[model samples]
Target chain A: MIQYDKISSRDAFGNALLRIAEENPLLVGIGADTTKSMGMQKLSEKYPERVINIGIAEQNMTAVAAGMAATGFQVYAASYAPFSTLRAAEQVRTFIAYPNLDVKIVGGLGGLSGNIEGVTHQGLEDVAVMRSIPNMTVVIPADAASTEVITEEIARIRGPVYLRLGRGAVEKVFDAGYRFQIGKANVLKADGSDAAIICNGAVVARALRAAQLLDANGVKARVIEMPCVKPIDADAVVESAAATGAVITVEEHNIIGGLGSAVAEVLGGRRPSPLLRIGIEDIFTESAPHNDLLDRYGFRPEDMAARIGQFLSSFNSKNEEEA
Target chain B: MIMKSSVAELREAARLIRRDIIDIAYLAEGPSHPGPALSIADILAALYFRVMDADPRNPGWAERDRLVLSKGHACPAVYAALAGRGYFDRAWLTTVRRLGSRLQGHPDMNKTPGIDITSGSLGNGLSLGLGIALALRLLRKNCGVFVILGDGELQEGMIWEAVMAASAQKADNLTAIVDYNHFQSCGGTDEIVPLEPMRAKWESFNWNVFEINGHDMEEIVSRLEMAKRFTGRPTVIIAHTVKGKGVSFMEADNSWHQRIPSKEQYDTAMRELAGGSE
Candidate 1:
């Protein structure tokens, strides 16, 4: 089992950005007074000449980053999830995405990670808004280790990509040795019988635990970690459906236009399956602790397990009824 | 590179742009602000013809300067200047707002070669130009980014946000030219939302201010050159101009904001423009 650590992911991103800044003179970092929050302070401190602190202007920061990118600088505009994605969304759409500029929007506090900050700060709608724009790559790394891997991957890629990291603590799901390719799903546990619980980001660990509970009950649950939501690996999804006949998508993001929706779109087009989406119901969240919010929003291991059980029973009943 | 163009040449180009604006207004289903286009023709000519270090052969060159038409409704004037600049073939001007044409009602950066940003939503170009200027500064490239703001477009809060950011950053490479046509879509700016202290507003935001006759090609060209030459502060050129400059009947007329001229009016406007210069 890979060790999970939030600080580790933060360190990976910070260290990678610093190293990239040092090596690539074209790389410039801009933060909206969240260098410490997003772990960009290391880069900011090390490369003070290259980093720009725009105080609290997320919109201007994003637009300036796009401008810097246009001038041949590899720019990373970092900020809190809500303000960075939604507040400067127009800049992201026109200046960055529409022009397909080489600017990386690294948003901290994805999903309910900013739990203490409440609904106003929680970036539950980031994915939904970002996915609507054309020519955008969206990635949610499951852990800190994956964060480092994906950061390096994005640094090398040419187009616009949104790399979202969570707040508080998160588990590490990869190591220095683990290789990651963009747009490819990672199969954590593979078994053919019961059902496949496909998940991303913080929900990966919860889905794994749910799969383990199902395995004890003679239900061979396969858990897959789909880190990249856009350009989703359709073949893996189709294969999982063919094997299990029932698929459940779990994520910390809302039910609309996120991982679950992307997976459902693929499955709907190719093969029909009994799909149960496990995420926030269509409702705005109130202030609560991280764990409390997850539980309240149906993101706990028990929640996924119960949803999978219901889906399995429903799939069997439907088959029997058809027979 | 030294730019040496005569006033007569610049005025001729402005007159041709005015003619093109009237022509395009007629083509656009008789629903365009032809008068506003005529008003800004001289300033647009000064920039596209005499100022702005841009190459028609390579519009997107890394070291080349940038120009953004923040007052986007006056696009007929811009299209004329761009055609004159040879950024695209002059024939494309006839395809303005037509299907599958680079020329749209407003400038689309993706479609037009010389256009810097897609601006139809008013009060956005200043901020967008700020981004471009900031990028040039970050890259440490010696180039200027100019944005032409309408007197009415200043009603947008984003423009002030950009103005503050530019002043705070001391983005000397950037310059904003307010058409100061003294009118908006509704009516005269003072009658609608008074900005009598327009120069003070920009000066308070920490910008170097220069007010001039926008219709004067010499003044327009000289002030733009000065804005590009000077450093350590962002500059604002508040050019006082008539809304429907060359057209007698439409000048300062609010109805001319988006109305296309009738055949009789077009004939008279064409005669006036043609009678002036080229």
Candidate 2:
């Protein structure tokens, strides 16, 4: 039995920020009245001079962060995913991205993590919105450990970055010793590729379990963890597709412009292969428990395993017909 | 210490800057916001020529006071002042809106030296200024951030948000100047959206409000000095002036807000600004 230590990505992000602040005194934190929720309260308390709560004004907060960046301060602005990535998107695009300021935007409660709050709070389309902006680096950590790694990495990078964090605790996908690199996908499990399950954010662990389930069913599936969605690892994607001959992309976001779309864009242009996107269709999610919502959206490990199996079976039959 | 320039000297600098504005507008291909630019010539003159601690040769000096032209469409005024102050060659002023020119239609800090922030979009300057003020405070730098906002830009909600935060933080190092020409694009400010109770608005937000005749060089200099002295809160200088103050035909006319002057109109403007053709 695998021992799983679970912690919220928000807590990991907050802890990482506190650690980062101790080393870099020039680092400043700005919040849009979401200090506690976005895991920035400890930083605000410890470094009161460095942390600024700009009330509920996300737009002003974003611009202020940019202004701080212009003055040579490494700034991180945090807010709810919807508010930060959508409400203040124009500010992010104009002030931070256009000027290419070194501002890191921390988006909390991405996707169905805010499931209990319904569509209003759920950040279903944040990835799509942020990925479209020029000069923006979009990162979604798979678990608490990766969240810490990603937080530290983005702070070191000298440009605009969007770090998406989940609301609740999730099973650990990587150990503390796991090396994190920007724009590189981590392969969690690899075997003879009947199919490859590419996933990111809160769904990576599930994809791993789905791969195990596929193994028991006599199908060898590879699990690839894509943390950086914008500067996507195109080589890893193409290699996985070429080796497996089938690809399944899973994300806790809309299927349109999330990791699935990013992977499709890479493979569709460079290498053609059978691909299946596993994510929320074009629709709003209703209020429910987080796990239940994941299940309802066909994102549970069992569902992923079943879907990948079906896709592989069809893929094999098609190949057989061609042969 | 406040730098001083005689009213006559400041007046001459303002007139020269106005001529430069017209010259640049004439050279540009499309319409530029010359009326608003001409309106603030004296204010810019008082700032660049007298008040501001900036060196044109060293535009990126760390201790230098920063200026954010929030009312960005009126960049002709800033561009001309920068040129007159020797931040760049005066010859480059002719390429205002030309392709690949550092002098973009609006201010871009990365592209242009001496521009502190990129601000063509209205209502973003004050917030950006506040950020710089906070940064200065954090670094213990004794520098001030001056933001020039358009009167019509007051309609944007983000401006008020920034206004509230600057006072709440007690950012004494920041000063916001409103170029209240009483006009915006399309019509008079009253017909569009009145900002008449502007003094009360800033005061209510906990800012130190100073009302002055923007065209008067003396008032512009003194008020800016006063704002620098007042500590523990941000200041807002409401400079009342006529739109297109230098030119007779363009003065107080909203249609001239963004209209490029014809050859005859440009000649008349230059002649009037050059002290009635010698």
Candidate 3:
């Protein structure tokens, strides 16, 4: 369990990176003019010598970070999710991932975290682009505590990693003393489940809330928080599917290639189940409040609760009809 | 003058590199731009054999000088020099673009040894080299970075983007050489993109510019030696040479950009390459 005040994922990344930088002098923080946006400014201020502010060149910044990593420096290149994952993808592919350089790419405002920044700012396609690259560890933290913990974990591990952190405040999912294994999924609520709600990133909190709402309506729902999207815990996913017979994956990214897509891929090829993937459709986002955007994109807790109710009702009707 | 023995060995290495180019192209049935490679044969030989401090056994030496072959299609020459320097088994030079060979049609850094950056896409090498130069400078490493850009490749907008950044950063430890072979794959560079006043263009970008006859061993080595002594800004060596220097039928022929020879033509080319005794 992480013993810290509830904070946003981006803020947690900021706080956690500062702690790691204290011990590792080789750890350098670089931002493509998004230090404050990604909450890397804290790390910058704490370790001024280690932080490199590369004005506004995202492409140059990525290549520069890769070069630094090649020369035996642990580099964390920070920027918004869309820009870091897509805008500088070629650089990440050629310099960082292909060469297997030690670059920790911290992408902030994943999914619709930057609600008001509109569709352009939303990173619905970030996971799709990053997960395709070989030797890349794709991580989407469920909340601030996990984000901080994962940031510390990747700093110790070598190779390229893409850590997605959300903007804005999020509810805490894990309690104090919860150990976060990098590629392991945390089963938040298990047993006595009518359906399983599997989610990642900050959307896990919403899934948890929806589970609570389902319990209030006489439906037991198990909420699972899957942080590592690339090397997904298939055992956890299969166990949830086996226990509940139906699974719902919630996330703030695009349904095409985000957490839902990853889960569907595992579930489709392995033990198949009736899986509902809740996320942004294949559409661009525009500037709006983060919460309002979440609501509009059908990712709010209420939306998730409604979806669970529909799945449970349908499952019950099918069971009764069989009887 | 200072490193007499090394320079003499490099000259012999240059002759071998020239011979390897003729042999590799003939074996693969792949016609490369021979003039550019023949002209740059001495420089490549000097760098790999004498000037650049590298480890063939340990290609990943941190302090080794970085080389980016911006004109990657000229790998026939580069592969020859790399083999001459013992970066890989010299026999591997015969499998230039064969299946499962480390050598690709273009240089792949992952597959090939001593290739600092993967570059087949023109206009990307300088930027990649710039990244390496900047990274080394940031780490306070005292190693030199070298990039060889083709004259035709200079037409790419990314090259200028890199030029502006290199100049702005004042990367003194980096040196860029333009293989001014006067011809591109299509035709003469002037007829294609018209890059006249090449030296002035580099100078305007705040680079220290030098022009030399690329094939002349003395000028090529002297300019490279001078580049080390001068500092405060990056240096660009614009080496002028004919397109296909050694073979009479292929000399100044743009058709040889990638045109392989017939059996008889191959024999003739070999004869011409071996001082035309046949």
Candidate 4:
């Protein structure tokens, strides 16, 4: 068993931002009254001049970020995922993405992380909305370690990027030495030729655990972490499908227009494999504890393991029947 | 403030910009917001030719004053002004909205010279301008950001949010000019949704409010200059204007908001703009 340190992705993002801002004076942080929640409070406190709190207005905050970007300021604006990607979506699309401005949008509390806040606060559809915009690079880091690396990488990259961060603490999936790239998938564990589990965001650690469970049951599973969903790692996805023959996608987002859809788009053209998507069925989540919501939505490690095992068995039986 | 040119010369420039606006609209052979575009001819002329500190030779000079046409449909007027000020070749005006033309129906900063920001969606420019103002202040760059908004665009809730933010931040380097043409796509602003008490509303937001006749080149220039001198708060110059100022048939007529001129109407408008007999 790997000893996992627990930390929230939002906290990692905040620390990474502060470190980057210290090196680059041109980097400005803007928040829509979500400084504390989005992990910008420390940056705000340290560099009071660089951080702007645009007070509860996501639309204006996005536009302001774009305006600053046009003047050659590397700007990052943060808010709750739903508000950042949906409420201010038009601003993000028009001012930032349309012009391909260098404004990094950090969406905290992505997926069901905003637990107990009910449907409005939860950001289950952020990936769907953000991925649809042209010139928008959508990134969902799997754990706190990767989130820090992703934040540093996005700050170095120029153009519009949507970085989705989770609210709750998650087990560290990557080591401190893990190098982050924008459009590459990180393969965590590859053992079995029976099935492959592709995952991202908060569910990646669970997917790894599921793969472990599958391995013990004599069904070897390959686990791939796809951090960047928009410019998805098509090469990795195709290779995994060709090797494993069956695929299961795990995410904390809606099954539509997310990791599953991205993988399907890749494989439907390149390689045809029986794929099962494990995520929230297209529906809003109710108020509950974050862990309970994760389990109920089929994001738990055991649940994902069981589903992948069932899929592998059915896929193998179908192949044998065809033979 | 020193006047570079006589008010009569500025009036001639405004007249020429109006003429160019009609010419571009006719050549584009597509829908154009002529009413709103014509309405802001004098304002655009004053800003481009007189009030703004910009170099036509070097359009991207770091210290140059910036303008964001929040009401992007009125781009023809800005295009004409940019050409008139020699930001680009005068012949480019004929290619407005043509296939692969730099002058898109709306302002695109990357494609067009002298355009600082891409603005088409309403209620975004003020916030964008506020952001630019903030950056300029932080960089210690002595430049001002001017954003032109349509009165009808005030209907968007985001505009109020920007208004509140601009005031709360005390963006003294920012100035917003509203072309109070009084007409929207559907009908008059009052008929659609009342925006009266507009002056009081701006004042309540802690903005320095200046009301002027948008068509009067002198008033436009003087007020814009006054805004530059006024420090401590951002300024909003409410320039009351007719929907279509020069063309008699289209003036105050909301039907012409997005109307492309027929040959007869176009000829009549060109003649009237040329100070010819009707």
Candidate 5:
């Protein structure tokens, strides 16, 4: 059993932004009538003038943030995930990504964490949209600790970044002193050789627990945490796939375009390993409790463990038949 | 710093920019939009020559005013003005839209030295300008931002969002110049989308509205300067202009909106623009 702390990545990021603003006078925040809901309440309270609530206009907020970035301000444009990515899609691509502005596009309530709000609010396809845009650095921190570190790290990056954050208190994957770097994946558990569990965002800790369960069942699996979705750790992915001979990618997003596609792009005929992708399988999710949604979507620890176990058992059976 | 030029000098500058536009169109390996470019030449001449305080030597001067060419297709006009104002060499103007040239079909702030924001996608430029104005105000920097808009571009929903937000924030340091050339890529804005009651619309939105002849060099300069003094709300100058102002065959013609001039047409335009001040 692993100890877990519930910390919302959005809150951690907001707190880190407030702390960062203390020294950097040019830091500006743009909100789409979500200053409080998006975790910028504390920052707004402390420095009310720094945050501009654009009042439910996500597209305008994005371009406004891009404009602010042109003036040398490290800017953050925060809105709900669906509206930020889908509704304001062209603005992000045209104003920020094409220009390579230093504007950080923050989307709160990523994935099933916006479960109670249903498909309208959830960001099941944000990573896909963001990854497809040129010059966009996509990041989804595993937990609050990683989120805090990533927020600080990406602030120093003088280019466009999309930092997706979840709504609920996510199960903490890293401890207090976790170090993070953009485009690098961290291996949490390396004692396994049967297969590797590569995941990002809040699902990282669940992947670790699934790995632990795999260990108990005499099936060893490696757990790798991939935070940066774009500029991915292709070297780690190739090596891990080559070492374990199999790869399973877990994300809180659509399996079609998120971590799975990224990994597949990296392993395109080079590794030639069997790949299994687990996520919200290209369907709209109904409103429910966050954990129930996770469970239904096959993101729970036992669900992943069972699925990986079945897949491995089938692979072994095929190999035995070949032998 | 502001270039202190007389009205005659500014008119001469506008003619030169118009000539530059014709030159680029003639040099084009493909078709280009010379209609919108021709309309905004005088306005760009007024801003770069006498009204706006910007430095060609230091394009990134923190204190200098910035221009967001919101209607980015009119960049041929902007490139002409920037070249005339010494942002870059006049040689690059001939290389417009050419492969590997810094003068792209649209304005790119990174590739080009003096472009404040990369704009071409309409209805987003005003917000970009508002953002810069708000930022400069926060830093207590005495600066202004000019956003050049197309009348048809006003039909975009995001433009109204920026318009309302700018007034609500009381962004007095921001100015938006609508090149009301009465035409867009397709047809006349009045006939197509019809942004009529235009003045009342902006006034209702609480902007300091000023109507001017966009082709008038002195009126353009004075209205731009007055925008800086007008406080408590953002200023918008709606300048009425012709689609293609100078040449006889192109004036008020929708056919010329996005058409690159043919060799004979280019020679005719150069001749007309050369014999200026009618």
Candidate 6:
């Protein structure tokens, strides 16, 4: 098992941006009244001239970032996930993605992580929106270390990117030895093939914990952590479907068009298999503490493990009886 | 890098650009915004011929001034200017708005050589120009950015946001040209969302405002030159123009906003524009 550390993904992104600023003098940060909350305040403090605050305008922020990027400057637009992805959806699509400019749209407060702030602040549909747009590379880091890694990699990629981040510290899912490729999936546990848990963002650690519980129950399962949601690792998904025959996808977004939908699209195209989508179903969640919301949504490790166990055993027993 | 085009020279160029706008629209075999494109012929002529310090041989030359046609539907005029400037072959004008052509219906920076930024969606060009202007300032390059916004496009809420931000940044390197052509897709802008006391709106936003008759060859060139040198804040030139200046039937007519001219109408437009030739 890999050891875990507690660090806010937003802070990790902010610090990585500072490092990027140190190297890239032309790096510009554009925000819409979300500098401090979205991890851009430090960059503003350090390089006042570099950070161009656009007040409370999200659409203007995204379009302006595209403009800056077109002018040959490395640009990042930060805001709440909903505002950055949906509110500025057309600007991101037309100006940034259509031209394929190298602008990273960093959206904070993804999913139920901002639970206390209610549905308005929560970014439940952002992943779905970003992934659907053509030429947009969608990324959701599992933790601080991975956020830093993805941020560094995103700078090198010469196209538009959407970096979805959550509020507060998340459980670490990787170590110093961990490797991150933009479009490859990382297998945290490959011990068993009874079931495969494919997950991303703040839920990868929970998926790992659930796999451990399945192991204790004498059931071997594989756990895959996917960070790059767009240009997804189709090979990993196909292999997992072939090995386990039962795939479970977990996320902190709407189940309709996120990791579940993306994985299903890959599997339905190549490898047909039984799949279970675990996330916020097609319903708006109410305000609560983040952890309580997780538990309430059946995203707790123990709850997820029980569901996985029931799914595999029930399906297998039916096959056995039929045989 | 320098070409001083006199008023007579600019008038001839504007006449040819007007002819190209009609040619591009008539050749498209579909409805195109000949009205909007015709309105900005003189403005683009002034900028391309005299105002902007851009090299036609090298579209991506560093330190060269940039123009973002925020009102992208007027790309026919811009395409005519770029082709006239030798950015591409004049023969390509026949293939405009056609498949595999670099001159798309809307301005695309990647597909076209001289386009500085891709813009079609309204209220976006000003912010894009501000970004370029800000970057040019940071690099200490004296390159200016010019953005053309339609009168109807000014209704977009985001335009005001950019207008406010541009002033707050004190981006003196940027200049906005409002083609106050009096019409949008549906009808006259005054009949829809009236932006009357136009100069006050920009002045209240802390911009350097200049209103001029957009079709006047001398006034268009001189005022644009003045705006190029104005400093301390962003500038906006509200160039009052008829929607279809050269074509009498289309001018100030709401029905011809994006409608392409029939063969007979095209011939009249061609003859009228050609008559202004020295």
Which of the two candidates, 1 or 2, achieves a greater DockQ against the reference? 2
* Better lDDT candidate (1, 4): 4
Most accurate candidate by DockQ: 4
In the predicted model 2, the residue pairs found to clash are: none
Error of 5 at A261 (Å): 0.8
lDDT of 5 by residue, A1-323 (tens): 55555658888989999998887888988899988888888889999999999877999899889888988898999998899999999999998999898999999989888889898999999999999999999999988888899999998888999999999787877866888898999989987899998999888888888898889999999999899989999999999998998899999999989999999999885677778899988898899988889888898889899999999888879989999
Q: At residue B90, what lDDT does model 3 achieve?
A: 84
lDDT value, residue A236 of candidate 6: 96
Compared with the true structure, the alpha-carbon lDDT of candidate 4 equals 0.89
lDDT of 4 by residue, B171-278 (tens): 889999999988988888998998999999999999999999999887999999999777989999999999889989989988888877889888998999995333
lDDT value, residue B34 of candidate 1: 81
Candidate 4 similarity to native, TM-score? 0.97
> What's the C-alpha lDDT at position A281 in model 4?
93
For each of the candidates, the C-alpha root-mean-square deviation to the true structure, in angstroms, is: 2.2, 1.8, 3.4, 1.8, 1.6, 1.6
Question: Per-residue error at B179 for model 2, in Å?
Answer: 1.2
Instruction: List clashing residue pairs in candidate 5.
Output: none
TM-score of each: 0.94, 0.96, 0.89, 0.97, 0.97, 0.97
Model 5, range B51-121, lDDT digits (tens) per residue? 88888899888888889999998899999999998999999998888888999988999888789889887
> Model 5: runs farther than 4 Å from truth?
A1-6, B276-278
Locate the minimum summed-lDDT window of 10 residues in model 6 chain B.
B269-278
TM-score, model 1 to reference? 0.94
Per-residue lDDT tens digits of candidate 6, residues A203-232? 888888888998999988899988888989
For model 2 chain B, the run of ten residues with the poorest summed lDDT: B1-10
| Tens-digit lDDT string for candidate 3 (B74-131) | 8878889888777888888878887788988777778888887766557667766776
Q: Write down the lDDT of every candidate, Cα atoms only.
A: 0.82, 0.89, 0.79, 0.89, 0.89, 0.88
Clashing pairs in 4: none
Model 1 lDDT tens row, A1-323: 53457474556777778877777988888888877777888887777767777667788788777667766778888897899899999888877888788888888888888888888888887887787789888888877778887888889987788888888667666676656777888999986467888898877877888888777777788889898887788899999999988888999888987888988999999998888888888788988887788878887777677778877987699889999
lDDT of 2 by residue, B21-118 (tens): 89887878457888889989999998888877887778888788889898899999999999988888988898888888999988988888889877
**Lowest-sum lDDT 10-residue window in model 3 chain A:** A1-10
